[model samples]
Target chain A: MSMQDTASSGVALWRLVADGIERGIADGRFAAGDKLPGEMEIAETYRVNRHTVRRALAALAERGIVRAERGSGTYVEAQKLAYPLRSRTRFSEIVGAEGREPHGRMIEASEDVATRELARELGLKTGAPLVRIEAIRLADRTPICVSTTWLSAELFPGAGTVFAATRSMTKMLEHYGIRDYRRGATRITAGIVDATDAARLDLPLGRPILVVDATDLDLEGKPLVTKHSRFAAERVEFLVEP
Target chain B: MSMQDTASSGVALWRLVADGIERGIADGRFAAGDKLPGEMEIAETYRVNRHTVRRALAALAERGIVRAERGSGTYVEAQKLAYPLRSRTRFSEIVGAEGREPHGRMIEASEDVATRELARELGLKTGAPLVRIEAIRLADRTPICVSTTWLSAELFPGAGTVFAATRSMTKMLEHYGIRDYRRGATRITAGIVDATDAARLDLPLGRPILVVDATDLDLEGKPLVTKHSRFAAERVEFLVEP
Candidate 1:
């Protein structure tokens, strides 16, 4: 129906188009991971302009019901993977249990001096050497998060090299004779993705990202490493455990 | 002096502007909660065009270092409020502890039927009567979150009316003889604000919001109410307490 036909129904025309697509997904007319019809096709089916269909699709993408790939058509989003926050959380273990292959690629590594805040957080002196590493984490070839991790360079000498070689922070720590660590504190916020992280996470610029700042403590309750992770919000949900 | 001068230094012009502003904030040249200079003023100070200044400001806003007010100038953001996701989370208490006034205004409320998912979540029969309430929560007159809450209408008759009059969900629960409740499961995601919620939250469109889906349980471990709260990400940070 045209805008005038649906205008009297008290709902906006774009909303109606969105609701129609939602119903189609609910009724199995559009299956999970299925590519949605082209915007022109949807416009024709709904008897609306392409603009209306585009708005409807944007709404769906915002709701995480579908995702638009660069230069590719939109597809219905699969079920969101649950990422749990708990003591001793392991990314590889979590994704493995979910039947997804987890991969972490080291983007870069640098050795720097800790600022006052970093020194206090890591229980080290100011100007202490620190190893910072950035990596992109993926599950089953789908980019999930971009994480930056920081550790005391003196404590874990050559950590950047180790992490780059193993692509596993846990393995890097193990080489330093630390086999276990527990979560200390986690602070979560949300923000629009910047250009660099958007490309690294394979998300559209301006998409929401869950910013997680966390610290891992050794078994003795000493800070081991601090991490800043930006997760693609549509692809995952964070479960906070009591 | 301009893009050409900054380009040779290996940093984008917009990035230099952003860093200058950030340094201003750090050195107390631009104090928190202080209104920043207008875009034109900033451009003149940085010897760049207004578009470059605008891009720099957008970057700062994305980083939560600044916030733009509609039709007003940008301001350096104050320290973010820490929202702890504990078993007993009281909004008023949290805000009061932060030395800010807390208010909840009911936008709308209605009686409805629980869908299958809602019924499953609330441990009620499908199509059971439900009461849905929408409210905008504020701290010191700044909109923090827009919450949609659902309760079993059969269990708490006239809950919406009670909440509308009291403006406190805790008081409404007290009216229903629920003296105590604890948090159950909490799920967090992030998404761009929709038109309606952006208005309700006084946020710019496309701003990131933290979507928190939480269930409150009675002392007996039965679900009492399920809440979907969208918090303005720039104004608050969620702390996961151990």
Candidate 2:
């Protein structure tokens, strides 16, 4: 039957093709990392035109089930990185434990007055002096997240210089006599990446990003730092630990 | 200046309009539940065409920052529901604690053989008899999530009937002499809503949804149920408790 004939069955043609391929992947007919059939081949097999096949592939790509390479054909996406959310969550440790190289680069650092929202989060007065740092974190050279962190400048003077020397937030805090810290709270919301963040993370505009608004507390339960981090949703999945 | 003149400043007209309105919302000029300016008024204010303003509004709606009403104009979305992720996560309790009435309806229920993935998740043999239940949960008359849950039929006979009567997995399991359960592990991912889910949840197609894969274990840490829940990303934000 033609594609239009199948549409009469109450399912869209493109959706049928997409569901067929998804079932194949689930059944191990198309294994992980396996390149999918070309557009012309999929069209022939489904008795649909190339445009229908392309639409199916686009849907799959948007779901993060498959990825289309620039030169190569479409391929099934590998397992996403499982990021554990716990009291002592650490980015470098999480990526390292996953057997991937973790890297963080400071994009910009400056002294600034805390905004009303930031001040409330950090339990400080608005316009309080703070050290603001913008950084990008990568795993295996793939950009995963971009974070903007704010710290009380009075507590950790010259934190930017220390952080620049050692690309580790823990190490920088340690230099300031803070030995340990834990996650205070984390609020996660989903949003589309804006143009500025899209360019910084090398992601396309309108792609989904997980926004994490978090605070870290010192050993005495005092808020040490407040951060806003945006993670690429397709590259990582947060595993909530209780 | 004309829209073309503003577009030459390295940003698209639609994005500029979106950013302008975003700033207005952030600065409290447009509070939550406030109706946005009409398309013609926005076009006149920004000196852009109605099409560009519509595209900007569409982008905002996609991000869930603003919602469009069919007959009424657009309005900023209210604060998202904060869903806490913990070992003893209870959906009804969560909504009730937030001062909202919780409701659930069974969409489909049947006895089926466990697939490979479901078998692995529940530590059951492949093709084992399973009771599958599909449900949609709502809070304050708004649909929040659609879930598919599977339990071993051998362990919980007549679970489908019990769940249908109770409209709750917890209550249904209690009827089978299983009193308590805890969340074992949760895996979260983001995806666009498909046609079936969009229709069920009253969401627009291509909007983002948070897919949560979780397993609930009994007192002895034996897997009792495996569930996949798709939440409306725009209506809720998950708070990971540590």
What lDDT score is found at residue A174 in candidate 2? 94
What's the true lDDT of residue A38 in model 1? 89
Misplaced by over 4 Å in model 1 are: A1-49, A52-77, B1-49, B52-77
Model 1 shows how many backbone clashes?
A: 0
Check candidate 2 and list the clashing pairs. Answer: none
Per-candidate alpha-carbon RMSD to the true structure: 7.4, 5.9
Instruction: Please give, for residues B157-192, the per-residue lDDT of candidate 2 as tens digits.
Output: 888888999999889988988889999989886765
DockQ of each: 0.33, 0.38
Model 1 TM-score on chain A: 0.76
Interface RMSD of 1: 9.5
- How far off is residue A41 in model 1, in Å? 12
Identify the candidate with maximal DockQ: 2
* Chain A TM-score values for every predicted structure, listed in order: 0.76, 0.78
The weakest ten consecutive residues by lDDT in model 2 chain A span A3-12
